[model samples]
Target chain A: MSQVANRHDALDVVGAQWQAVSPRLVTLRRLSLSIVLVPAIVVLVIVLAVTQMWWPGLVAAALLVLWLLACVLIGRQVRAIRYARRDDDLVIRKGVLARRLVVIPYGRMQTVDVSVGPLERRFGLASLQFQTASASTNATLPGLVATEAQSVREELVRLGEKRMRRL
Target chain B: MTGLEPSISDEAASPLQWHRVHPATPLVRMWVALVALALFTLREVDELVSGGYREILALAVSWTAWAVLVGVIAAILTGFYISWRCTGYAVDDERIHFKQGVVWRTERTAPLDKIETIDVRRPLAARLIGLSQLRIEVAGGKDSYLELGFLRLADANVLRDELLTVARLHDRRPGAVTTPEAGIAAEHSSIPVEDALYEPSAVAAQHVLTIPNSRLFAAALLSGEFVTSVGVVIGGVIAVVITGSFATLAGVAALLWGFGGGAVKRFTRNFGFVVTKSDQGLRIGRGLFDHTMQSVPTERIHAIEVRQTVLHRLCQWWQIRATIAGYGEEGDETMLVPVATSDEVLNFLAHFGARWTDEQTIALLVQGMAGDRHQAGDAFQAVPQRARLWDPLGWVRQGHWADDDQVWLRHGRLQRAVSVIELAHCQSASVVQGPLDRKRSLASVEFGLVSGPVSKALDHLDESVAVDLAERSVAEDRRFRQAATAVAGKSGQVL
Candidate 1:
């Protein structure tokens, strides 16, 4: 009876919440996107002011507008990102207008990598990447709180070992 | 440069003794390149000199020039000799070690178990020199596969068998030695051949399938490439007649060359292909110029596909390819059978444990291929009518079926192929929906397969159905695995 309970426990994903990532993810993406924007704007301004090239100025204005629109979209994109941890699988949901949900079972999990970039570390954020035998099916849960990411990685590693299956 | 993690190397026992490769290993390759280069240089000289062939020949053979060329060749040979000296490898029961480089030192250790497949490959040049290369494939992205080359052919084969025997845990007694040297020396020196005691002398080989040279050639002629080339040639001639400009013929010639070359490559890659079965696993042997023998334990094969084009259907022929965990090159499908008749295909599939010898199953396959899948009576679950909006040509035929643990996806119009993968053996399962799919309340389900003979999806099912399928497959996969373990007969082979 206990073994049957344990077997059913592996399918326990009914009421799991899709936990949202750190809101700072938006700021991180916006900052990174702006890093490229600043240099291009600087060059465009100098080229336009010195050469009096209207085309360069026009291009720069268009790029600035597009970058601002992207900044807005990035905020929504970050807000929409969420993940759920089940007994046997991990579920990732992202996108606003067109949503995409990916479910990966722990049994198929080969490696769980926790990465903290300089910018992410500064913001106390980390990312966890999942690898499987199939190279193309890798999924990443980015912008988790650093400590949460570490604990989740450990939990996943435990589940992966428990649910290990030959590929 | 091709090394494993430093931590793994640390855990491994240090290499016992280093063995150097055969001296002729680098010479054959370098010699070929040098001869090609010399011929090219002579051709260029002949073109440049107004005196043509005679003057170029005289200039090429001038005493000083001849001396310089010979000196260069000598220097290269010496470099190769030093390289051969510097490069060395050592293998133990648990790991293989490679130590190479002079200025930039490098050492690599690969655990015996992580090895996917061990192939004894003999390129034409290497074979001529009685040498072979042992290719060890591990599951890393690129530059992951390691090769030990320029060894005597017998030494390579013995080493391969010995390594696989240990790595696969086929034997517990660690049959001859912990080193290739002892094994090779034992085989070469006229000892009592005690090592042969451990090695299975010979099992009555099961001759599964053999594609004749004539059949292979005929298949190539009926292939899509040849058909396309014929069409292109006819169009090129018609266009030439209409425009009356012969330069347009260049386009036709180039396309023809491309098609013919590809078909010829496919043909030769599968030339004299033969598949045989033993108690251990399947022995796949092919290649005319660089014969390769790949032994894939049936248990290691995760996925398989049987395909037929329109012309192939007319000829009642099919091609079979399989996905062995470490046997396939990263992004390319390995051909298990280039071409075989329906009966041969059925026989081959049976070896993989698919009980499909009956007339009913053959009829099921024929219906699944081209007939209305609905007539199969629950043998397949096809796409809904609305899904036809997505695949205008093949939507009606697109379906998925689960026979025992094997989940099969069937799709394709002009070229119909059925890919069968045991879900329990697959890596992962996923469901995705694009904007269009979302609007239609539909989604696609895909199973993650290791690199080879496994690239397909169950496309255009209801969103709910797709998600439910993906989620349920996880449990089904787990259940099958556990039950399979409990039974655990000679896994991979039916007998």
Candidate 2:
């Protein structure tokens, strides 16, 4: 009883093997942001050139600063993401400012999907997504080594099947 | 993944046959899409007619445009026809199969034994066309279901009965066909294309409860919608005072929805609502214009929640809801009692075999007991007085009870509620902490129901208490499941 009380005294503890996502996830996040942001910035700079206004140049600089801030935020967000496999459930901890730890039981899990986008594939990473009975419990573990993601998906499916069979 | 392949028995000697939906189905499904396309085309034609082209030949362009329009219409019709031809459904002895789409094809199947509910829906267009869609709700979750859309109304009803019959028969004996359900299904399935007709099978369900019009009206008046409406109206008045202008569409819409829309929706959905209980399970028949029949078996129910909004609390009324597997956001169907007294709510739960014999209620520091004195007692484990600031009026009411086969939770301030969750049906349990909670060393325990949108909670407990509650609830759930499995192993009967 004392151990249980002490374990949950600190809020951040999930107790065991909470692994952070691959550090390359930061690069993937930055790359995806730049792909969208770079084009928008270029379009804004072109508009500024056409308008030939000093204030517009200031606006373009402000936009560039916003872009840099977004990149930093994305990096922090990717870093904050972590996951752990429990005895009967999977726990995903995410978010920097308003943190959320979603725990999904194996019995409740319906599907374990692996999604890989072109950029993610180029970076040798895949996202493992879990679809549970409840929408809120559903979670995605982004930026895993492709093989690791596959193994996790296989393990989850196996565990889910076993639990459901017992039911 | 579980629903991809159709479930079939080892002795299935009959060849699997594929059949398409009615010819009118494609037209019905794509009518809205086609209408929008036509509207866009009409706007383009208007643009061409109104604009003056100085360098181009207007007469030649007009002729080309007409030709293009004709060709596009022909192409669309051909595509619809091809898509309709490709889409098909079949009834196997062990499963219901559906294959749809042209480019991105999907193959969906639902096992006979796992089928939860079979619904026959008739939309306005389908009604006019004398067609109905047979929706098969299965146990595996949201996406693991099949719909055989736009079959003849009679055929649809027969098909629903057939599937249900097969499922029931399967339940009684896994592979044996001693009953007449499979026989009827087989006979109906073998009917030729031109003469597919079967009589509406009489459903075997006993009349349980029929809500009177007066109670329905009271429920509407005491609903969360009514309270929300009142709040919105006050907010609108405040906004008008602040802005000194009424040029807000949102304000008008909010005002309209708060009063009339909410009341109307409640009245229409619950008007002439009736509940029936049978060996198959419980069925709720509701709706004024859009008549609906929702069915769920007794064992399929995940959890039963009893709530009281502020207005209802003042009136000593309670609303009881059941969360069944595979139902997502469909409110009226699961609501066993819309508005009833606390005693009445207990009686209703008794009818469903989830009677909480021990009466208990914690005295809130503020907003003390409202009504029905005999129904209230003290059984809940309360949060500390230090947590009072977290929920001023409701902090004392935030408590839980875990014993036997049930976990009882009490919460809410002006609108107090006591949600009764069966330990056997709970999907998951966890202790959640936020930044504010961490500062105060407080946490909340949430129990996830198998179905429904939100989790049941005992909010803002001491950190240690929350952890204890979570562990106890999980242990209870595990014990319940283990016992159920043991019973099944001994008797080959699953409850």
Candidate 3:
């Protein structure tokens, strides 16, 4: 236990083969952020070019810095997401700063949902959500390779049926 | 998992004999609506005579108007009667089949084993008419709630017994033993009524706890809501006096009404609370005007929570609530007892298969109730000092304890609540950390539970402790299940 405490990944499942999300998720994140922020940057540039005001210049610089910060944060967040299907339970770990780990027995799962946003579709990634009887369970494994997500969903559904439990 | 199948069936394999609810079931509820409709019609007819609508009243010496009103009443009553005629239910060996509706007919089938609760509810009106309502709650959702209402009270009681005998919930083999700490309760036949909590009355089942109506009333007075309501009313009155304003008196009247209504509701809901144990499950009887008898199959409770405010604590009173498998949070039935002595609470816990008979376990449970007193040994996995950042006064008070079968979480500074959840009931587990917890290498853990009053979480433990606790829970759950299966194999029963 002390050794586990000393380890950095102590809160995470240690030996189980962990599956990381598609790195393309980071690109997808950047793309979505760009969709929302690039226009503002463009608008700011236009406003600055028309007026050549010093404040707009400062604002543009600030926007650039903010965009750069978002890029780093999104990359870390996407990379942090990991999930593994252990013998008895499915473990999901995510978050860069705070971190979280969830282990749910397949029998407790009521349903599995797979969804893909336009951005995620462009990046060939899908998100899996597992619903259990408990409302507190927040087991959403996002940014999985599309095919892997489908296979995992099927596997989970099969296992869930084999060990189905009432709420 | 074991009881979900129609196994241990005493139910006769008889052909479906469809039965209709009391013909008056529709009228019980719709009568109120019908009265409202009649009153509105009367106002309209009165206006026709008194106001400018006199021309309409003069058409046929008012007989046409009366005839139209009577026709409308007849049409509505016919609609209700038709609906009553259409509604029917049938019980076969495997499931309950209910079909209702006159135009767009709807049918529902609930597997006998999946029935969560079979409760007898007698609304005041139904009681007055010597009728009762049987509500069969299936755990999945409200859409599955089946109500066979306005049955003769005697008929409802017979049906409730018949359904209880057939429902899979009753087949659950007894012990939901949690961990290594609580030994398997060997004797369940009956315990002596030496404890003061039991009313010294001869009863068929083990007379466990019976709380009187006066105690319920006193507990309500000591309740937080009552205190808050009084405070608000007093504050309002003082404001009116200081401002010399008559307008603010309306707010005071509203406050008074709120206080009186709340008190009446508390009395009606919790009157004559009693818990009894039998071979099958625990029987909870409560309520004043609308009597309810809830048959809680002992194995169905996911967790048990005993709570107290400072005032109630001072009076040595505690309120008991349990998370029955599919009970909605707002349902009055979740309450096991409204007011109980600590001894009565312990007596109740023993009924759930915990080893309250053991001195050490009793100590541990009591310690869990009041929270950390810096006790020696493995009494609790106390929160780390770093938790003080989040809750300075309460950091020392919060704790988590597990004895192979159950997990106990106790926390609070002024008002403390301890929740006892058997390991068998935990469906999932989680370890979470906020940014601050991450900085301190600490995490809080929550074991997933069915929706009810039980809030199972232990915050701010060493990351290692949290992870170990959560992971060990899966192993514990599996071990308990395997042990239960082994016992079942020998005994021809499943836990």
Candidate 4:
């Protein structure tokens, strides 16, 4: 019984160190979605105007519902996103429904990339990605402040090279 | 520099010069381009014919047409020649470098010590021309290495042996006296240096495993892929009969035949597969139409997976696969055994340095049908009761065993899978808490090995247990590396 109790508290120590990204990520997410969805909605409205069909209106409304649901889900997902730097490994945890926790060793990191789009730049946000040996180890952290992304990229790259030399 | 330069006395001592591939290399490499050109010309001929004989006669008589045709041929020949001439490769003391392209010059180099595997592949056309392609898989992921093609079979083998020797030599200590003297002596010797470098006879010949043809054929017949393909064809034919779509029968038949033939051919390619143990590495040779020889060092293997599909479980058979870096690109290269009984798989895995101390793991695998031992208390740490919501059926049997050498995770009830990841190969560990798991205060611990799609997870453990295991796995990974380095230091060979 003591063993079981000990097992339950293992993660309590780890929860203290996780750093959350910026809250403005929710706005960036909505803006990126609207860029594509707004145009799509316009096209659907145009189709409805020309054809004057009930089905197209129904389809447009359905899409609006989906977009609203996506906004809510993306907000939750952004809230759940957290990154932590350990002694030897970098950990990223995200997702709400089907959660994923990716831990990549510094020694295994081959490349660290920072990408920012026009919309993200306007929102002062950028994404950082690290490529490891395994193809499935998709180590990505999005919605970080642009300055934070740059510092993280540089730090990870430097740390990766140092660990690699030790190997 | 003059057109006719004088030969120097130290030419042999100088760094290896960049050597160009054979002249025929261009033709072999650009065969796809040539085929496209031929098809385009044929289509042009069809248009010309429809335009009538007069146009054809006019084209024949026209000097411009003749000049255009000559120019096109000349342009193609010049391009091929330039591409071939510009591409050159050199293997020096420390690295292998390849330089290619005319306008956009590109140079690629791979450190000699980073080469993970050397494979000699021969396609049907290359085999017909008595040539082979040498692929050097590097430590990094795809697109990080170089592939040189269309070399004479003998030359490719010699170059492969040289690279292997350099890789082995790079791992030794600087002051090791026997290696440098032996290396120099072996270079000058008339016989191949590889034969003298290591004692091949140290590994007994009887230990090597060879799969016979009959077994391969039976395995193919029992495979789920083969059965489903046949069923699809039959189902299509039945639909055609009921719908009376006789006109579409030929097209459907042709498609099915093509698909079925490719599957069968792939299945039978490894009919006489043989794996032999050598001083440098394990040498694998197989395939009927395109014979291939590949060598991978034992220490490079990342993880091992033993899969038993629903059908395989009924027959008490398992398929063993290894997750080797730079191997998962091709489906067949990573396979250890296509199909084998529990005993055979255990025997084969023993050679690869996996030992199952507890017979309970094996018993659970072989005789899981009885269902009596599913809940038996053993050394394995079973998942908590909260896991019943996630796994439900197999929650009792789902457990993890972390011995000194390997960490094994078993899951699933009907189609069971047991992944044995060597402790040494574990690069990192992670604890994942899903929404459902967080509610129950449980988490899953995942061990990240070298690049491969297959993953191993010990799911639904107590949150504390998961984190503890993750930390322990990292410690074990460090210990394994230290142990390997110590062994390599003592043996004077990079195991």
Output the number of the TM-score-best candidate: 3
lDDT tens string, model 3, B1-495? 222222232337555677988888888867688778779877876766675566764844768766886898799779988999888787765577776788887766667657777788888878888888888877664345677766898888677766665553223323423331221342232332222113332236787888988988888887766887888788887998899887887887788678867867887798988888765478888888888878787767888888877888788787778887667676788888788888888888787654767777777778877658476664877888877897787787788888776888888777778888877678789999988888887899998887788778888888888987787667765575565556546656544
Isolated chain A TM-score, each model: 0.87, 0.86, 0.90, 0.83
Candidate 4 lDDT over residue span B323-344, tens digit each: 8767764567787666677777
lDDT string, candidate 2, B121-233, tens digits:
66656767888787777766556567788888777756776666556555444122212233234333544322321333446768777778788887787676776777777
- The true-versus-predicted C-alpha distance at residue A104 of model 2, in Å, is 2.6
Compared to the true structure, candidate 3 yields what TM-score?
Answer: 0.85
Candidate 1: lDDT of B238? 95
Model 3, stretches more than 4 Å misplaced? A1-8, A51-60, B1-16, B41-77, B142-144, B169-203, B255-260, B354-356, B376-378, B480-495
- Provide the DockQ value for model 1: 0.29
Best of the candidates, lDDT: 3
Candidates by lDDT, descending order: 3, 1, 4, 2
Query: Model 4 chain B: which ten-residue window has the lowest total lDDT?
Result: B1-10
Q: lDDT per residue, candidate 3, A46-95, as tens digits? A: 89999978787788789889999999999999877877788767988899
Go through the candidates in order and give each one's DockQ.
0.29, 0.11, 0.43, 0.20
iRMS for model 3? 4.2
